[model samples]
Target: MWLPPSPGQIPFQQGIEAVSERFIGAPFIDNALGEGPGSHDPDPTFRLDAFDCTTFIETVWAMSLAPEPKEHWTDHLQKIRYLNGEIAFTQRLHFISLDWMPYHEKRGAIVDVTRDPGLPLAESLTTIDRKAWYSKMHPAKLREFESRFPADKPIPAFMHYLTFQELLDNPQGLNRLRQELQKGVLLANFIRPNWDTIKYIGTRIDVSHQGFLILKGDRIILRHASAVRGRVGDEDFVEYMKAYKEHATLKGIQLVRFKSL
Candidate 1:
């Protein structure tokens, strides 16, 4: 759920560069349930790739099923899974967003430089809808979401929003860029919510902006830039790669090269 800065806000790119340089070396701890690596009594609910907003929420829901840990809620989940055919003990790593999720909201602004070839960067952000743009690009995963609930719903596991200035200021929106990071969560490796690795840094931070997460041992960095038809070239890419190295230096974190999406 990360995207590049809109065509506008190009001036904020320096800030983006600064932020990415801040969290290269900070430890990446998982906020998901289960035990951390190298523990003697590993967590039973741990899954390899069960990261993302929806699966993160579902895992929490599943954990809240019982106080004593019997197979109480498995049947309830199975009923839901039969319709979607996706619930399983080991299949947690393969969860994807359902189709029925809502798409857009009227709040926030937008910038559309991709559609209009001649549109200037500054003009794009002047009149844009944040939800509208993402709605068109990534429609709701409706089948995965449900609305028939009680009086209320809790906040999502991770809520990210990034303005054009924020995106321009921090391309890799790592949490360590802020001065004081305050969040109501913990990174743990057991079912009891024992360990938590949530922290924040820098000035402006939101999930909607282009950011990367290194939970557990895996790192998934999301970037949405204009399709590099001709503007960006090999040299620019090399500079970007070098920027990663420099950012790692600032944060004192070492990052191994992973496959790009």
Candidate 2:
């Protein structure tokens, strides 16, 4: 069973530790892709027995905020997953950099600390064309989903993201990234560069993955649900970044830190 720190525990690093301890050997399940989008109702659905990367982090964050997390997990999940705590499918925070992070930051659930380390970062905008990629649903299902929105609802044009190449080019930014890693912040990996048109169209987000940062003795570790490893696991943060750098398609990373309201 999943367990996490009581509400009084510190957020971020402490919350991460609690989640890490509780789910050390949990299996990675692609539950999000399998179960997340097809539903017609606005209710929040979650599976604790298994998790994908996003669900794992979301669950831990919700649990960390409550004295008895299991008792209130759904309520917290609803708040974190949807805008204004509404249960509508369209209200869900789907895009990591564009939707999820920005929503939470605005609500005081977290802070975008990507530029806080004084990194010389460059920004760029990307469009999430849901129709081009997310239109895979059967026409009937697509119609059902779209019916929830007003006919005049305008699609979002773009969102800002920091480039990994910029960090690679700037020694100062690299150093700052390392410094932030040492402090144990939440990180999201942007895999836009590697995603082909078909792949990008399906997901409609620049950020492909996310995880928590931790310091164990002198080593920095990324504690997350590893799709590659097929389970929840921890790895050296720098080594993971090295692997990401080697991938031709991975663009780079963005950082965020949890802050209590």
* Per-prediction TM-score: 0.21, 0.77
**Candidate 1 lDDT over residue span 24-81, tens digit each:** 2222223333323443224433332222232233333333332323544444233222
Across residues 73-145, which tens digit of lDDT does each residue of candidate 2 receive?
5677778878787765566776676678778878888877766767555453555554444365334345544
RMSD of each: 19.5, 4.5
Residue pair clashes in candidate 2: 133-201, 194-249
The backbone clash count of each candidate, in order, is: 39, 2
Q: How does each model score on lDDT?
A: 0.24, 0.63
After superposition, the stretches of candidate 2 with alpha carbons farther than 4 Å from their true spots are 1-14, 33-44, 151-175, 181-184, 191-194, 199-204
